[model samples]
Target: MKNLLAKKDGELLVSRIYQSESTQFEVKSCLIGGEQVMVIAGPCAVESEELLKETAFKVRAAGAAMLRGGAFKPRTSPYSFQGLGEKGLKLLARVGEDMNMPVISEIMDSEDIGLLADYADILQVGARNMQNFALLRKLGQLNKPVVLKRGMSASIEEWLLAAEYILAGGNSQVILCERGVRSSEPWTRNTLDLSAVALVKELSHLPVMVDPSHATGVRSLVSPMARAAIAAGADALMVEVHPQPEKALSDGDQSLTPRGFSTMMRELEPVARALGRRLR
Candidate 1:
């Protein structure tokens, strides 16, 4: 078998089929690839209009390039909050317009792609549907950018192939996200694979980001993991932040407070600079 990754001319090569090609795109005023480390910080779900507004303004003030939230959450349990649906998307659009920041939200059903694309600046395919080929193909047909999260149980090859589905369909504007994966250890919510961050950068040209909030499932661990992700060559970071975690309707345990997100941004500056990257 051939090596999946290698070094060429002092640069890492990821895969023969998926050769590394730098993909750069703009989100409003933020440049995704090249030298800028994009930070996308917001709540896990849009609980309320007021809360979404508060988190949006705070994260933007903290230098977040884009705001992220879930309009259609796919929960393990049916009884849990499933997001606010179109109402949440509307609120997110309003906030992004008012704040002059682009917004991203999860689109579960392929049927909702048009509606979501109309409101959200970017469409996110959550981990649960990373291999949903039909959805991936549909996203490929759209002009909007899609953020594809790595599945909890998917291997590196499998994850890249999933991205292939989107690319083959004619849309090359894809962003890969590493949000940790299932593991035997029960101490943390999920075992974050920092190695995958490095591997993805070597394997594909797609811009890869990390989700430390979901990866660690602990507020305190978020900052450290986020810092490590930047140092490890992640192109961006998607963090979950809420004004008040205790009052959040979903994923409150892993959500960071506004203050916590600000501090993390500050601490990441030196790390980003050392690596010759700028965190805006």
Candidate 2:
């Protein structure tokens, strides 16, 4: 009883010091069966079924445990290429099942949850919708797991509080994603705060992942930042991969080539192993 109390007290201390969410979540294992760290890789947006399938096949072949695609994209420009919506989601669902992997796609609006949940194994909340409390609460009420990305400008407390909104709503299968934050620097699209990766692991009971592709907004920097994220204690990574990045309609600059992804996967093995984790 004394030891239990002490341990609980220790946890409380850590939470206060680091703004943690209680580090005790059961991270879902790879669907294909492995002790390796989970990797979700695919294109940033679903342009076409053929393109999506091609990228999914290559990434899965390179040992990606899950496939990612943005079915309902939240583009900055109204004139920019919007996603294919329900049709695109159907494609992702089909590809995931046919390819023998789990599917993940972003959720934007509250009304689309039921339809999106029907197809997605994991519902991803993009950084732009991090504080969409209504959506978060709705997700919390669902049975499927949610991958919540930190907002671009939200502080650590606000980020966790957003997660808390979900947790408090009753859903506990939440995965925290550090996808970088808005910063004054113009070199990188966003400043990938890897320190938050380590901090999340230390503070929350939820599995913490990183999105280096969105963080850097450049393909060349994906591998290095991915490695760093793992070193900082990320349980998973959400990377963008495309067969022909230059031809991609959205986020082409940040999507890795098949060869580049394969190389990064090879390099990630050692980092995961060194940290007492394995890479699938």
Candidate 3:
């Protein structure tokens, strides 16, 4: 109990203890942790320049402020498609510039920090690497913003402590993302833990975002859970949008079509407005 309480105190993040406001920062023109519930949408991976450009354009039209696509993918299987690497980062940077939007992408190691920071506007520390203190500290020293996703098996205190690793390194522009938690139920990919969204609001001053696409791992559930996230007070959302889900290189089942994403954006507006926030 004592150790748990000490963890919750988040010694390294005391400056961000939840009061009545959240820490805000700007990525290009998008104000993260601000009034609007920012949305980041794009392919799960940089399959190709054409596919990436198409998805970026569509999502931007649907009201997304920032774009996202993985360059260094951390796959569970050894034989699975390991992302396009640095080449993918170049394409992501090019498309993000052409689309006139800020972009976010994952960082798997401290060595690749310089490479990813060169292209991505917001460097994302994926769920699997949540406890990677070494990488987290490297990210903290960067001037760029970082989106830290919650580890599937980690507790809330553990998640905050991971962010502390970055905060302790001196980067205050950290956004916590809930991508769901591992569960026994096989019906859904992972339980979306909406409670965490509300809880983080009270436990920390940092803004919280949700990745419904990964949380449910089903296209149909993405939009509904996205709405729930907004109602639950998510400051932003990271959704995967592939032009054609059926042909996606990765996470196709959970990716939304361009048209489907447009429809989902339309449906999310009222929910955000009801909470006195706008769906960016």
Clashing pairs in 2: 20-203, 21-203, 22-203, 22-204, 22-205, 23-204, 23-205, 24-205, 25-205
* lDDT of each residue in 83-200, candidate 3, tens digit only: 9999999999999999999989999999999999899999999999999999998988988899999998999888988888898788888999999999998989999999998987
Q: Which digits, one per residue and each the tens of the lDDT, describe model 2 over residues 1-280?
A: 1211123434322242433344433324453112446898999888899998898889988999889998888989998888999999999999988898888999999999999989998899988899999998899899878889999998876787788778767787778899999999999999999888876565655678899999999889999999998888787899999888898888999999989999999999999888788876
The model with the greater TM-score, 1 or 2, is 1
TM-score for each predicted model, relative to the true structure:
0.94, 0.89, 0.95
lDDT of 2: 0.83
Q: lDDT of all the models against the reference?
A: 0.88, 0.83, 0.89
Residues 199-278, model 1: lDDT tens digits: 77766888999999999999999999999999989999999999989988888999999989999999999999999999
Per-residue lDDT of 150 in model 3: 94
Using alpha carbons, what is the TM-score of model 2?
Answer: 0.89
Summed backbone clashes in each candidate are 2, 9, 0
Report the lDDT of model 2 for residue 243: 89
| Residue ranges of candidate 1 with Cα displaced over 4 Å | 1-20
Q: Model 3, residue 21: displacement in angstroms? A: 3.3
